[model samples]
Target: MSIAVQDLEAQVLGLPPEDRARLLERLIASFEPRSKAQEAWMQLALRRQEDVRSGKAAMVPGR
Candidate 1:
């Protein structure tokens, strides 16, 4: 189920202090992009592209 931002904020505000902190942390973590695997793959792809552009690497033709 989707929640409105205002509603989520209100609910979080009503939580006990420690609970609120934990909830906020979880929410922030959930919204963050770029998991470890994705970051690694992105780095690898960028390096490959650079290598190809600089003539340091070449693509093999597919059969």
Candidate 2:
């Protein structure tokens, strides 16, 4: 690999978690921003987690 690319990668790695996540989200969203859909799914997932935790829902072993 090129030294310039390697140095850039090192700089990126040095970024804080929040900064890195923001940069990554922008890069991916360049293709298409599904932020709303992502938020909706996250909310639904959290609700499902709460349901499982409260025994409002049950899981069974599967093969």
Candidate 3:
């Protein structure tokens, strides 16, 4: 990798967990269309919702 990219990677890697996650969110949004990602998420959510409703799955309480 080029020096500039290496430096950037190091800086990104140094970010705190939350900062890194937020950065990742922005990176994905930049490359992926909002509607496409939203559609995928919605599909997964609906399937999970139906699973619980149909008694095929159950929601676990978060600690």
Candidate 4:
């Protein structure tokens, strides 16, 4: 099941308020969990944040 995100976004934006709310509810429920690679990437992101907070890593400008 594939969708063009931009087209869907445009259609959703054009909907009436009540219909938009209903459609958004269905769309939210249809989303699945992150893949293994995504999970690994998220873990790395969290660890990097922890390292920065503990002064073990330096922040880069414009990040």
lDDT (C-alpha) at residue 15 in model 4: 92
For candidate 1, the 10 contiguous residues with the lowest summed lDDT are 25-34
**Considering lDDT, where higher is better, how would the candidates rank from best to worst?**
3, 1, 2, 4
Give per-model CA RMSD: 12.7, 6.2, 7.4, 8.8
lDDT at residue 62 of model 4 (Cα atoms): 100
lDDT of 4 at 50: 99
Q: Once model 1 is optimally superposed onto the true structure by TM-score, how far is the C-alpha of residue 39 displaced, in angstroms?
A: 0.5
Strongest candidate by TM-score: 3
lDDT of 2 at 35: 84
> Clashing residue pairs, candidate 3?
none
Better of 1 and 3 by lDDT: 3
Which candidate leads in lDDT? 3
Ordering by TM-score: 3, 4, 1, 2
Per-residue lDDT of model 2, residues 1-62, tens digit only:
55798898899899999999999989887897668888899899999999999999987789
Clash pairs, candidate 4, are: none
Question: Of models 1 and 4, which has the larger lDDT?
Answer: 1
Q: Give the alpha carbon lDDT tens digit for every residue of 1-63 in model 4.
A: 888999889988999999999997787757956689978988999999999999999998994
Candidate models: Cα lDDT each:
0.91, 0.90, 0.92, 0.89
Candidate 1 residue-wise lDDT, 1-63, digit = tens: 999999988987898999988887787868878789979998999999999999999989999
